[model samples]
Target: MALTLALESSSSSRGEGGGDGHGSCRPRESMFEKVVTPSDVGKLNRLVVPKHLAEKHLPLPGAAARAGGTVLCFHDARGGEAAWRFRYSYWSSSQSYVMTKGWSRYVRDKRLAAGDTVSFYRDGARLFIDCRRIRRAGVVPAVPPRQPQQAFFFHNQQQAAVQPQQHLVVAPRVVVVDDEVEEARRRRCLRLFGVNLELELRAEPLLLDLQL
Candidate 1:
């Protein structure tokens, strides 16, 4: 493209016939004309459409007579262009302006969704439009670390260790004793009491003899 532009520039300069034999050349006019500038472009309007608009015609807001039943050209970032038709009509005592044809194709190609914004512009004598897609902000929760299956048992042990005194209470145990063992304990007690009584009676008789 640069080479093409350079060649066109050289050819236009040659066409001016620059030969006065005094190292002088006639001034030549620029072959390329200035097209639309950034300041010349302005956003005419913006529209936020719903999902249903993709299948149905898109309604535009403006003077119906100016845009009614007229063809507008759209240019994309890739320099590709497509022609779309604008239609205006009256329905039930109300006027409506819409893009009747070529709209569905543009929407499908761009994969537009609900909440997506579309803006129209007036550049020179041409109509141009651009789209801005709306995105939702989301947050993904963090997953907790997994514990082993035996964690429950270890958790109980940890609780017990934290309060050692609470786990130190001993439960009483029941024992069965034989009748022969009970009888032997009773006989031993009787023998010890019987010997003490006999000694006391003998000491009383000696005291009576000394008094006489």
Candidate 2:
């Protein structure tokens, strides 16, 4: 009985130690953090990167505007694991703001064009920006001017002396009728008949001679 009690006590101690070791071996938390959605910002506010922003040096809004900082980290939309750094400076030309030094490189890498939008949000001390590309209007292909189409009119052989064969070139004209006016006219014409009948019904009008 003494030997059996000793064996049971040893087994219990081993089981408790194994459980504690397993708990301690758990994986650490992820480095990447969750970003706040644009909707959460009142009025869905975001800064739109102008055409000039990519070309000339410009001052971007900083922490006051929720975009200013000395260093910003850009996370890949595919996955937040990949990140790029952008160094910026805060200064006051007219007012205090943050200007990104290496923003041009990021713009070139993303192939961002004028009218594209970008928004920035903060995760603790880190600043992150999201980009949205705008589709530019394509250049319209030039259409060559159409040459006039000559329509030949031939006269009867017997009447060739009085009337000669002639060529006529007709210029195309587009006529636009006001829908409101046309509808009003149609209503008036229907009311004149004293019965509601389809406009296809055509009747002759009577004429009287008034000669004294």
Candidate 3:
């Protein structure tokens, strides 16, 4: 395949060109799409292209091409060019073609994972790549049930000392918060015992203990 890549910089998806007053039409463009595999996003950091797709869309590997694979520039959906050039090469051991050298960073920046879909569109000299993330069920959590107000204990050492027989109690303050976050904060307060109360209450822990 003889591929020349360039940014379209235009909004037109379908366009016409090359007319010599004769009845002739340009060949239809081809698109390559594949599902992302674990190795594509894993430590291997390379994408495996099928033999047919590689032959039909990528540069054929020769002695010089084998030594150093051709660098292909692919554009993203937002018309952003990739920071690194992707190397396209043919592997003899597995008799497969693969994309390497910059693939790792591409997947990382795109946040692509296994089971996602990646596609390549070849329009004349321009090439575009897009990613579609896999959809998972139950990703959005259901709304939690409403609960009573949250309370944090303030251990008054002075009050406890004054009335050793009676347990010291402090008035509870109300704050609107998620149940899980509030429960975690309550348990943390119980463990710290006002040591870090200012984090949740936004006031001096010792001062609040004394005032209450």
Q: What is the TM-score of each candidate against the true structure?
A: 0.31, 0.30, 0.50
Q: What does candidate 3 score on TM?
A: 0.50
**Leading candidate by lDDT:** 3
State which candidate, 1 or 2, has the greater lDDT. Answer: 2
Per-residue C-alpha lDDT of model 1 across residues 1-212, encoded as one tens digit per residue: 01111212223333223221222112322111111111111121212223243224333333533434345464331123344433333232333333434554444444333334444433344444444333222211121111111211122222333221122221222111111222222211101100100111122222111111
User: Which numbered prediction scores highest in TM-score against the true structure?
Assistant: 3
- Give the lowest summed-lDDT range of ten residues in model 1: 189-198
User: Which residues of candidate 1, in runs, are more than 4 Å off?
Assistant: 1-68, 81-93, 138-212
What's the CA error at residue 149 for candidate 1, in Å? 51
lDDT tens digits by residue: candidate 3, 42-94: 77879999889888887565874578667887755334334346888878888
Quantify how close model 1 is to the true structure by its C-alpha RMSD in Å: 44.2
Please give the CA lDDT of all the candidate structures. 0.28, 0.30, 0.50
Ranking by TM-score: 3, 1, 2
Clash pairs detected, candidate 2:
62-68, 63-68
Cα distance off (Å), candidate 1, residue 52: 22
Instruction: Give the local distance difference test score of model 2.
Output: 0.30
The digit string of per-residue lDDT tens for model 2 on 81-150 reads: 4455666444344343333455544444443323344444333444344454332232211211111212
Better of 1 and 3 by lDDT: 3
